[model samples]
Target: MAKDFAAMEDSNRSSNPSIHDVSDPARRTVLRGGLGLAVTGLLAPLGAGTLAGCATAGGTAPPLLGFKGVPVSTADAVTVPEGYVTQVIAAWGEPVGVAGAMPAFRFDAGNTAAEQALQLGMHHDGLHYYPLDGSRRGLLVMNHEYTDDGLLHPDGMKTWGAEKVRKAQAAHGVSVIEIEWKDGRWQQVRPSRHARRITAATPCAFSGPAAGHALLRTAADPAGRIVLGTLNNCASGKTPWGTYLTCEENFAFYFKGPERPDAHQRRWGLRPGDPVGYRWHEFDERFDASKHPNEPNRFGWVVEIDPLDPTMTPVKRTALGRAAHEGATVATTKDGRAVVYMGEDARFEYIYKFVTRDRIRPGGFAANHELLDHGTLYVARFDADGSGRWLPLVHGQGPLTAAAGFADQGEVLVKTRQASDLLGATKMDRPEWIDVDRDGWVYCTLTNNSSRGGAGQPAVDAANPRANNTMGHIIRWKEDGDFDGTTFRWNHFVLAGDPANDRADAKGNVNGDAFACPDGLWVDARGVLWIQTDMSTSAMGKGDLARLGNNQMLAADPKSGEVRRFLVGPVGCEITGATATPDGRTMFINIQHPGETPSERSDPDQPRRISNWPDFRADGRPRSATVVIRKADGGVIGT
Candidate 1:
């Protein structure tokens, strides 16, 4: 969720009434009934055994492994199905091609900023495997979402030096490494020319109409055409032309107070006097909004990187608009135009989409490089009846005009959250990662809203039916006709919670493998949707959520709404970022921030570690790592 620093403020002092708490009693009753029916319809196929023998698009049965799920675990090691095997490919602090041959990782000492820039970052989030020759060997591009100051520095953020600040910055970007499936095992191809790292210090270029806009201009780049780095890169996506799209999320917390902060900055949760902990402004004047003012504006856009070309500088496509962007997933229009869908991970924020004007040209990556530069950005609005419309964010059209403080189209893209507010877009719970299936149905994870059901938060609605949605849910929608159309029909795919608490379906039935806080999501080529969890630290292993055990990965058949627990992570870790091989044999998942308990995050003095997963070091330091899973029988995974 947008629960970085700004979300912390909301949970602490916000008093606005929930938008979902309607005054109309009849409407509320109708919505409640509709939600129950939606859940029933979504899972109806599962009860009838329709999904038991479903086939992929290629007319072959999906490899669901048929291995019953391992029980929910709180162990200090990863738990997988009986017949599956997992191996750690890479972990934080490991060398990833700095020079020709990278040095070994040293966990005992603090790494310099230069060394960090060359190593795999701290928290591994979203990732993708791009096959080089259609299979086996490929480039793995992953996002280093954020940093853990408590672990990065022994003394923590309260006593950080200049080098410590820089090291943290270097550890907050993306990493690309070359790997291959050799002898039935996945291993990194060390020192390969294809391996590279993009850190917060790496230089980047800007594209699209908002590239050189006034709001983006900085002292370093007066022309506003270039930027220094990309920060808080969360989930990611791959383009049809072979490139990685890394999203800059929760960026507002990185910079200090703005010179002349406005409602826009406040709406994004960047307020003065807030102890962001990183305190980057103390070392780098550019991070201080008061000095550079516009530096924060340069980040928080969908950045595209070509992993195949190691020399290529990442480009921040500004036409996609800016916010706490979780990520962007793309699908082609019937006419071949590219459409990208994204979600702003904030409470009451809106989901967005961008449609390129020109059709995707067939050929090399250079030929279609500028496709995202020219497009119409839109925000979604779902009606109570399950129908929705995409409202275009064009100046002088509707409420996005001079009267609304927007000068032109550029302003609309830069201050997208403001434009969304002016257009009266529906305030959702917290929309996170989104994925589009082969059938063009889009699935989004609304990762919980603790502020809901309270007197000053958004109330229950048809789409977000729960008052205090502690466990979060998934919603799916199909466009009215095609990817380019504005109208669509949507419904709830799953309402995640603890099944033992009488959290039954519409027919009073519950599954044994219940989960909460759906975050990372991916759909394999075999049509099996992979769902990951990120439970709140305070709620983990407590109450209804405790019964669900640690965060885990679940496989769901979208056609039947049947979900099965596939794997569970160690204590105090979130199971996220998943991708499977073309044949669905090798699957990669990210285990982030293990051993970071609620007490460790809040009470630094009396810190307690929960786990030291991946490497169960006796020193009590945990490292985030990526694990590769393949069936022992060499069959397609998740069968």
Candidate 2:
């Protein structure tokens, strides 16, 4: 979801300590020596390979990033370095190859509600590639974060009814399509058994400690075990046991509540009305919060889906805790216990981690069906001494007693934000996707927090050094011993901004390319850190962010801190959701909401004014699509 669309208000009222409140010596202690040693120590178990220029286990090393960097691009087009080829594999409104329905995308923006469901959903976000046979054939699963109603309908909100609402709902969720590379290019395997769509109307089951909680029960489902949908699906992750974790982000705005909402509803960003301009509640009674308050609770959870099996129902793992979840990144402990790191993707919110108690069994999905159901969730609190601790959100522990409004573990997980607040967790700058490198270091993207150090807002902190942080930074940490360890040493990997800027705060310490608003993050199989930017449409070509040009993706050598622009997106689009084939030769990236006007809505009469990306048809509307990139010589991506 777009930054302006999500909750921008600072809801946290806790007086917890900030990292800047500590002594100056500790506040500035971003030691590189400590990080170097930690990375070197963990390398052995991860096959002890190379870090860009460092020697590998075989005493021979290859450069991690081998391509020349592309320059800043402002034109309404996709740009990449020389010797690279790009193709549009999947786009919004394209046929998803459902067994009975395979409707082609209408260039006139006239796809019917039934046709939209049969075709690809809108606003492609976090995605993953599950290989079936090496890199030649696989399942490409991606989620549609949200829909722009203006472009969805022919009249653009001039008419409203249940049919329009159904179309929008159908466009919000996950899409799994089997794609195969043959005869020179990748093509969708039509009528694939793996082809499936899990939309907002799809049936989903609840599991874990909070499954049967009273707060989740509604008139439609008295058992509290079943829900109708999963919307606002953002960045995703893949479990070692062959499942996809699609996070529910910015789910609050989907509902409309009474003039005065309860404290619980207000904390999760539910306001008095649809200030974000979502009109779903008008036609769908289930979205009316006053009639069904529990509906929002059913969302905001990490929903797991098995892309290989179309018959398996999607499950919302409640043990991971409810939040405006950004994405879930999974890393296994040395002992094989699964540790999942997550970001809340909201201002003044906290980062979270879940540690499964049992070691991962080896039977894929069968033996580990209940793996995520049994886990202990913890929130992070970064101290100023380059150290951090993961505080357990278990009920009756610390201040999480019954008197504090938490009756049991179920309530604690449902109201994870409040629980984290009471525990004095460190509030981050819109924490987004989190990724762990092969060397066992955890990295998170703290996309900009404009209110930091503002009047009546939280002040500058060591962990978040910039007040009114415009260009977001990436923070990383190495766990003490195990992936599930409670303690860890932390530091800033890079503060993103223009190195030539005159202002002290905006002049970030970037080693190479200048960029802003780091959002999507991925540490590839070979330990290359890929950073994608999501510059707000309002700030893209204006003022301080003008030099950054359009939204772009960059490749960075984590050890050397050398950043280089890899690709730039078309006008008014976000470069997000990246994945690669098993061999690393074929890479996929999604361009979301191209031609998105500054107002965040396109005029129905002139949908192509801003961009017509991928098609460039005179009558075509801007569509969110996946860009497939591969080396001309079929070498590994970014090399």
Candidate 3:
């Protein structure tokens, strides 16, 4: 079904796994009044006669309306742009019985210590395709987020143990599969009633602006409004009405804290590497976060999900605060409200945006599910000449209320980076993903930082215009053109690595060659620019040329800023979390983890699998699938 690629078959190769199902809906309307048009991206990088003058004079090219170039080869499967074909769809414990049975992952039973509403949930990251109202069949809201315990548990998880750690915390959260594409392949529709799985015992609800506050009150919710679980979830963003959201990256590894210090560890901010419970807390001493410091404040923020009502409860919004969150994008604000945009992924941490105060009335999904719930979060400060400013953490701004030391707005939102480093913001290089193109720009991704001191410790600004950024960059902004305007204008368009590790200039690769920690991001709707990498530069044998190569996926050319590479995965993988299939010829990437294989390290039957790979269904157990790239005439891919 991937046909417009021009050529490259045997079902166009494949690889992509980690993101699960929904099985039958095809209602795609996006053509009505052209739905406002939007999504243009165009920028720099073109040559080779400008992609051979768009192709023809025997070079052939003219397929847009869908599918373009960026094939990226490696085998194991999924590599379109020649007439796509990747359909292995759903994975991760193929069962949805409601409380158990995904049991074959074996990462040493460390499912974050279980109770995750019935297990089979581990590492699936950001996904959303909902649809349903007109039928064409849909629903694929995934984001399992963590858990590897060695593989799921057979020789791993037992920091002390408890029912193998409550089936590894019920398997780590979120999953609503019910997909479809009929005979052209793409299955997984078994358990019905929308097939739920919300986890940590699902029952969420906490509107915004940090709900109840008091560091979020513990002993499990205590009036902070029912907060039991929603750890990690990672990279997600959907609401324009359909509802999906999901954010909470790395939730500081479920917390463990016990370096000894009580009075609830001096009232909350407990550090000592932050553990207060780690052994799954013997299965439920509230998971023991040092007798539960509000259970890590109920995990970073941004939840949302309602994929056609999987019993609808998942709603952690909290006016969007809580750090290490990695994703959230939304968009609106011209006057219609509903903003969103976020990042806070650590390193220097910051970059946010909320707005909301309820405005969006586009109608549907119960009015964007109460339009996100009271907003205006701001934070971001940049400048050295590129200009930037979102500021306004509210509560009379300057020093965030409660007399300055921030004892309000939930400690100015759990120390939202010490109130954006005292509202000065700007300290990036690990921002991680935020995407938003169709021309409102807003990209984000900074992903790299060797502790920056070879020169540049917060030096050379202008929205982080590289100074010690070894292999990482992709900033962008616009706002006034809308997209929730908050005073914008920024740059640093594409500076990845390995064009021979850079130094070439005029921009053509050089500084450490090409590819390093760019980290999960996406923009495709024809603006191109994919990126994706993470493992502190891939981390395999640690040679660090972004982890010895093959953790790729780059595109660029947003109208000629031509960056290439397209695909390379396999061997201790990392090229993760991507989304497409509104007819971008189906691309759903997410290879993830893959590490620890040197002949499987001390051998357990040659499991050294750095990637026996998707090798695209020819039989080679390296499976981790989610591929479907098309173009032989269907158009609109990398065009």
Candidate 4:
């Protein structure tokens, strides 16, 4: 659903019918047995019953819910296993905070910027459930990836006024809602003190070596340490210290107006005009690069928020090295040091890891508040032989010196892509999300690369072999020893596509559970990997891609290389953001931007409405919401 430079460039070129073409031999070799064997070997150490609550009454773990996977569905409802039930917990415009008189979501009317800020933000993406006392009551922290202005405002973005723009800004950050499981259902706790919303207008602080860098200074905040808010929060993770790590993604589109173009703006894809059509410059001068050039630099970093303490301001952890960060998953070494794996979600972007200089302090949030502030950031370089190395971005480490335009570590992190270029890191296909298994294997989702094998694009390599990769794949690797090590072995777990389509990954899609564009990913408590799809809007329900049906979630057994479709989302939506209870009984997933079907004509008077999911009314507008799923027999999910 998120488009970048590749999408814009492809749209401008002459329509090439061969863009999605896949050679038969290439498709057959996409998911080689060697790759699957490598992944299976790495995951084999995770014996059965490793996942909590997975064992049956006889003390043997049941075979994963291979319950004849759900069929491809085009219906306007969430389709899960035969016994599972789904209910909408919270939706957009539902009041969250302690504000008086909580209002019900209105389909026809629009909420004010202040009201929207107090409600659940739009387009819920990556989410995690933190149990306050190891039970049902906990905080649900999630990211509002982006906004759909057409549905947010009464007249749409075409006639957006300052108020509409402000409301849009108020809907783009993160939401922390208090939820509880009661009477066999999960529901939101309205007006709970823990229920708070952090919008783009909220104040945030910078931490780490790059905190006070000159590149981050802005007219509004000359100190360079204080930023107004976070933007484009896509995928997220929870830390060992109990804080939430929300990643900023696709933030370049929010800024415009640099009188003269520079390397920083060009590298980040910021152009002269509004590319994705959010003309924030029209309302705030800070959005104009010419007026506040350094403002954009403050974003694109991993933001840390302490959800337990609502009064505490979020921190932009600059030590993580900034980019279009899709998400950052944290793992700890035996020595208790924090190791975070992050992916830059853009075509030809590189994956990165950050290892803390000090081990995490035992005393919880207050004692380990600044653990992330001191970490060595490293970019990954994959080799053709299935081995890889981590290249540190420290200034003067190798070619990163004054001659290379990096004076200090702060500068290297501020321009992380340039540093990675100097280090010759492998350019990957839109790396979206990363999750670590109980066996310490790291998995990353490469969400397709349409530009591969094109005239001017990067040639296919062993890691990314497909020419025009319409269907995405997942790449996994193991650290040399543990999470803190540098080198590792890697392989592709699955190359996703339509099973009936001969051009797709036939071997991987043998069971007819064809899926494309793997995006949001999570490794649950039991070591089962859950993958969510984000098929392009233009490809969904059409041609070869249509056979896969709507975007869906799948459960995969890493050790056995067995994948089964778990749930199919409603029409015109991407199924993403998954988390489960500690006992692994109930699972929560976010269905983002449902019913987002685009119109073929440019008729403003008669806008096309494809679906109204969750609240299926012919006249109702579709709103993104969190879906809570549970088994009818109260058994562990996926088993």
RMSD per model, one decimal:
3.7, 3.1, 23.1, 4.1
lDDT of 2 at 310: 88
Measured on C-alpha atoms, candidate 3 has an lDDT of: 0.56
In model 2, state the lDDT of residue 89: 74
- Taking all chains together, the TM-score of candidate 2 against the true structure is 0.95
Off by over 4 Å in 4: 4-6, 9-48, 99-101, 504-512, 599-608
lDDT of 3 at 438: 62
How do the residues 390-505 of candidate 3 rate in per-residue lDDT, one tens digit apiece? Answer: 88787667867777667667667665655665666666766767887665667887776544333223333444434555456667766655766667766556555544432522
- Per-residue alpha-carbon lDDT of model 1 for 274-343, expressed as tens digits? 3365677788778887677788888889999988888998999998998788979989988899999998
Q: Mind giving the per-residue lDDT tens digits that candidate 2 earns over 399-513?
A: 9989999999999999998899888888888899999887777899988888888876777776787888988888888899988899998778888889789885787778888
TM-score of each: 0.92, 0.95, 0.33, 0.93
Clashes of 2: 0
Residue by residue across 1-639, what tens digits does model 4's lDDT show?
A: 354434542322222122122222232233343144222343334443356555668987678544558998988889998888889977888887555746666676367887788888988988998998565788899999887777787667557568987898888888898888877778788778887789888999999999999899877888898999888898998998898999998887788847665766777776666645676788877888877788889899999998988898999999999998998999999998999999988877789999999999877789988899997999988766566789899999999998989988899999998888778787778899999887777899998887867776666765676778878788988889878788988878777775556663322442335678899899887778888998866777576677788889988877666678889998888888998878887889998888765442112322237768777777677778999888888777776
Top TM-score model: 2
Which of the predicted structures, 1 or 4, would earn the higher TM-score when compared with the native?
A: 4
| Ranked by lDDT, top first | 2, 4, 1, 3
The 10-residue segment with the lowest total lDDT in model 2: 31-40
Higher-scoring candidate on TM-score, 1 or 2: 2
Range of the 10 consecutive residues with the lowest summed lDDT in candidate 1: 28-37
Of 2 and 3, which scores higher on lDDT? Answer: 2
